[model samples]
Every structure is written in structure tokens, then in C-alpha cells.
Target: MKVAVLYEINKPLVIEEVTLPPLKYGQVLVKLKTSGLCHKQLEEMTGKRGHDPFLPHLLGHEGAGIVKDIGPGVSFVNKGDHVVLGWMKGKGINSEPPEYTNGRNKLNAGWITTFNEYGIYSENRVTSIKKEMPFDVACLLGCAVTTGYGVVNRIAKMESRKKVAVFGIGGIGLNVVQWASVRGATHVIAVDLRNDKLELARRIGATHVINAGNEHAVDAVRTITDGGADYVFEAAGNIHVMEQAYEATNGKGLTVLMGVPKKEDKLCIDPIPLYLGRRITGCHGGDTVKDEDIPLAVDLYLQGKLKLNELITERIHLSGINEAFQRMKEGKIVGRSIIEFERSSPD
Candidate 1:
């Protein structure tokens, strides 16, 4: 199989052929069909999170694939079953990660790396999907869509007609806006630095859009919400924007943090807000129970309640992964960008 390996920080991934290791207990070998390009991977590659103990390793946390074979003790998924690969642990066995060597040195990988054409992942990282969903769209069920929808459904627990402000309208933030719209939020304010994103947010569900580059995001959100929003979600991994997102929340409202920050990153906030009833919480994978939630998200999409198809802004082959990351870094993509592995043959 061919996989993208990160040998150093701030370097293009090395796409090379590798031999798959023997599958261990509770592991499943998957032929990846598609994978999502996420900001978290970009952060890891650029050293934003700092330090690389796993220097030469495979990266990518979310994907869609078929179950090529099952190892000992694997049961939930069978060979030929369509599945979604995610970083979050779900039901089933959590197997040890696989090791891939290039005959000289060994390369490291997590239990759920999907940058490769094929992978041996822990059973818990693979969720079986029975619906006839496109591989590219299904790949998003692994992270981008799930995280956004999970943030609203599982964390924010938004009430109908509530005022909402979503900071940074990327894949995750855009989903927050979409779900808020479906949940009937009276005012869904989408804040971002890009006009393209703001416009898309408006089309998806944002009742109001603010380009942070042109005006004060907090002030604009406050104006739209009539003072402050009842719920605010920060998906942009910017400390300044995170602070502003908190500021845009009402005194009695809730603020959810969906962005992963650097190890040295810190939030500055006044203690008086907490004492006055304002609450803040951090979300990991939107606190989603992946095994259960992935199916629910699929059902919503099938029922015409969710817009999964519209979330993918572009699709490219594995060879174009670096350019895709560059587009994400420049904030040029309006939604999720996916890697269509099926477009190329295995090495």
C-alpha cells in the first residue's frame, strides 16, 4: 500500500510504497476509499502542537473504507462491509497500532491513520455503515460533519429559536451553523475572516455573516443577537478569535470550544463571568459517541435533514494532499476537502 509519511515538521509528506504488517488481535485491515483533510492534521504537520516523539509516522484520523479482512477477536465488522474510520474510540476492541517499515527504519502510526491506501486499524476506530452513502461524503462522517453536528447536538444542546454565533466558518464551524439552522436557532451569526466562507455560511443557515477582517466580530454578533448570543462556538484555533467568541456570548449563555490549540496556548477570561452564570466547555470530537452518532448523522442525511453532500468543497487524489493542505492554510476552501483514494491504483 502507498501511504503519506511525515518525516519532519513543516515538510511535504513522503508518499511511498510499504508492506502491511500482519493484523493483530482486534484489528481490521481496510482498503480506504476516501479521507478528509482536516486542520488538526495540518497543525500536527506544522508543529503547532509542538514536539514530535513520533517523527516518521503516518497521519490522518478520518476516512471511509471497506473491510478487507478481520483479525482475531474482531466481530462488529465483517469483510466487504462499508465502514467509516475515525480517531474517536467507539464500541468494539481497541487493538494495538500497526508498524510499517521500509526495510531500513520503522515508521510510526496511530491506531487510526487513513492517509494510506490501506490500513490496519483498531476495531473501535472503524464504524460499520449499511447505508448507500458515497465514499467521499461518508469520509466526512469520520470527523468534520460529526464534530460540527456533535458540538450542537451533544454539547451545546441548542434549544429552538436560540441565538447562536459560530466563529470561523470552516468545515466544522460551517456544520455548527447548519445544525443551528435545522434546530431552529432564531439568529445564527457566522463570523470569519473570509468573504467566501461568510457567503457560504449565509447560504447554509447563517442568518447573519460577519467578516472579522472588515469589522469587529463580537460587536457584529452582539448586534445581530440583540446584545449577546445565547450560544457561541469557537472552531477557529486562534486565541484572539476564541477570546472574541467568548465575549460574544450572553451573560447567561454557553460557550463551547471546538478548536485544538498549541500546548502553550492559554485563554484569558474574567472570573466574574463564571460567577455570573456564563459557562464554557471544551469538546473532544464534539463529545460524540461515534458508534451511535455516525449512524444517526447518516439517517439525518438520508432523510434530507442534513446537508452532507454540500459540505465537500473539493476532492483530489492522494498525490495532491500537500496542495489541499495549502488551500486549507490559506482559508481558500469554503468547506471540507477530501482525498479520493479510489481514483488511483494501489502501489
Candidate 2:
């Protein structure tokens, strides 16, 4: 199979053909139909979290594919089943990470990898979805949509008519906006440096949009919500933006940090807020339960209640991944960039 290999940090991935070892216990072989390039992968590519012991490893966690084969002890899915592969664990066996070879050297991969034509994922990393669900959009359920949904419904337990503000209107952020709207939030404020993203957010559900590059984000959010938003989400993966999200919350509001900051970065906030009932917390993949959230998102999308298609702004082949990464880094991509594999057909 041809896979994108990250041999070094801050370097472009090398696309090459590699050989996959036979599947072990609780592993599943999948032929990828589509994959979503997430910001998490960009962090890995740039070494945002510091030294990577898994260099020369496969890159990608969210994808939709058909199960080509299943190893022993697997019961969650079977051969020919449509599945969404994600980083989060679900109900199944947690197999060992797979390793591929280029006939000379070995390459490492995590429990879930999608930047390849085919992948060997742990059973717990994949969940079967309806065949009717489009692969391009279903791939998003593997992370972005599921995480955003979890953030709103699970972690925050957001109530109706509450004022909400989301910082960084990217893939995950956009979903946060949509879910916030769907949950009946009276005011959904979208904040970002890119006007295009702000516009996209408006189209989805943001009652107001603020360009952080122009005016002060915290002040604008406070002004819009008449003192501050009830819930603030930081998804820009920048420490400064996370701070701004915290400041934009009301006296009794909760600030949720969804972005992954650099390893050396430390967040400093006023401790007085905690004493006054104001709170700040970070989310791990939105506290999403993969087995539950993925299926629910699929049902919502199929029912025309969830906005998945709008989240997909661009679809590129595997070869164009680097270019897509550049666009995402520059904030040129208003939404998710899906990698459409050549052999997308389930057959």
C-alpha cells in the first residue's frame, strides 16, 4: 500500500509504497475511501508537542473505509462492513500498533492511520456506520463532528438560550457552532482571524462573527453577549487565543479549551475567577465516546439536522496533502480538507 510517511518533524511527508505485515489479534484491514486531514496531524508534522519518538510513522486518524479483513477475536465489525476509523477507543479489542516495511526499513503507525490507501487499525479504533453515509462526510465523524458534539452535549451540558462563543472557526470550531445552534443557544458568536471562516460560521449558525485580526476578540464577544458569553470555546491551538477565550466568558460562565497548545507553552489566567464561580477546563477530544457519538452524528447528518457537507470545503487526492496543509496553516481553508482516495468505491 502507498502511505505518507513522516520521517522527520518540520519536513514534508514522503509518499511511498510499503508492505503491511499480516494482521494480528483484534486488528482489521481497511481500504480507505476518504480521510480528513486534521490540525492534530499538522501539530505532529511541525513537532508542536516537541520531540516525536514515532518519526517515520504514518499520519492520520480520521477516515472512512470498508473492512477488507478482520483478525481473530474481532466482533464489532466484519469483512465488507463500512466503518469510520478514529483515534478514540470504542467497544472492541485494543490490538498492538502495526508496522510496515519498505523492503529495507520498517515504518511505525498508531492504532489508527488514514493517510494511506489501506490501513491496519485496532478493532477499538473503528466503528461500523450505515452504508448510506457518504465516506467523505462519514470520515469527519471519526473526530471533528464527534468531538464538537461531545463538547456541547457531554462536557458542557449546554442549556438552551445560553450565549456561546467559539474561538477559531476551523473544522472542529465550525461543528461547535452548528451544535451550539442546534442546541438552541440564543447567541452563537464565532471568532477567527479569517473573514472567510467567519462567513462560513455565519452561514452555519453563528449569530455574530468577529475577526480577531481586526478588533479585539474578547471585547467584541463581551459586547455582543452583554457582559460576556455563557460558554467560550478555544479551538485555535494558540495559547494567546485560549487566554482570550477565558476572558470572554461571563462571571459565571465556563471556558472550554479544545485546542492543543505547544508542549513548552503554559497558560496563565486570573485565579479570582475560580473563586467567583467562573470556570475553565480543557477537553480531550471533547470527552467523546466513540461508540456512541459516531453513530449519533451519522443519524443526525442523515436526518438533515447536522451540517456535515458544509464543513467539507475542499477534496483533494493524497498527493495534494502537503498543499492542503499549507492552506490550512495559512487559514486559507474555511473548512475541512478531505482526501479522496482513487479507489473510493466500496467494491
Candidates' lDDT values, in order?
0.88, 0.91
Residues 223-318, model 2: lDDT tens digits: 999999999999989999999999999999999998888889999888898899999988877889889889888888899888788888888888
Badly placed stretches (over 4 Å) of model 1 are: 260-276, 344-347
lDDT (Cα, tens digit) per residue for candidate 1, span 1-347:
88999999999999898999999999999999999998889999999877989989999999999999999999899999999999998989988999998777799998889899999999999999974877888888888777777799888888998999999887789989998998899999999888888888887789998989999888888888888999999988888878998899999999998877777999998769989999988887688889888998888787888787777888888988888888888877778888898775422
Best by lDDT: 2
lDDT of 1 at 127: 96
TM of each candidate vs. truth: 0.92, 0.92
Evaluated against the true structure, the overall lDDT of model 1 is 0.88
Q: What is the lDDT of residue 281 in candidate 2?
A: 89
Clashing pairs in 2: none
